[model samples]
Target: MKAEFFTDAKPLTVSKENFGLERGPLAHVLVNAMLVSDTAKGGSLQYQVGYQLVYKPDSPGKKLPALITTPDMSSFCRLFLERGKHYLLGGMLDQNGGARVDLCSLAIPWKNVTGKQHRELLSYRCD
Candidate 1:
């Protein structure tokens, strides 16, 4: 998705009472990560992971795979992640331990994450 599309997105904020209400299970994994490289892997696009956000239990840590996968859909339906930009990615993890992002996932530019949002993310809990 384009960063421009999120220009007017609602500010990311979470409170103990409103956290899951707004976010729901939008993603099982969430992080502010930079795209290191993009490689065509079979039918999916594998993006090399770079600098990653550390948000305790939700961060995924270093074991968060070197690559994150997304569908290689047609131009109009696919996600275009730039190699150098950082994104706040929110998506599911497959059984094999690989993460998968789709057009519907909470993928947004890292710059879009406000200070309050970052703090909320840092203290995010799955409970």
Candidate 2:
């Protein structure tokens, strides 16, 4: 017996809002980070992260060397995004078009993703 196809089936279309890019530029990539330094000032914590880009964007010379500030220290601690670890970061671009990963950005450990998933993410259009 042969299986029947459902002609009425429709493909699901995901909206850009689902990716949380409705308000800003989205830059997603894998990175290895090293903590350069961190400081607390006026109840806010700032971290200087030295990161190496694992995925280069379509436009050359667009990737920045570091992440200057992560607004909330508690959130940063919760994620445990420490130095010497690789993370898949989904960040927004600043006024200068440099990617900034902070409390609001999505940061996941690189070890958890599969190779296929990594390839798909790398091919995604950030612009």
The per-model lDDT (C-alpha) reads 0.51, 0.43
What lDDT tens digits, residue by residue, belong to model 2 across residues 4-95? 11111123334654332122222333334534333544333333344444444434554453543344456553234565556665554434
**TM-score of the candidate numbered 2?**
0.49
Question: What residue runs in model 1 are displaced by over 4 Å at the alpha carbon?
Answer: 1-42, 56-62, 75-77
Off by over 4 Å in 2: 1-58, 75-80, 96-99, 125-127
- The sequence of per-residue lDDT tens digits that candidate 1 reaches over residues 49-111 is 553553443333334455666667655245667776777765545444455566866676887
TM-score for each model: 0.58, 0.49
The lDDT leader among the candidates is 1
Highest-TM-score candidate: 1
**lDDT for 25 (candidate 1):** 21
Clashing pairs in 1: none
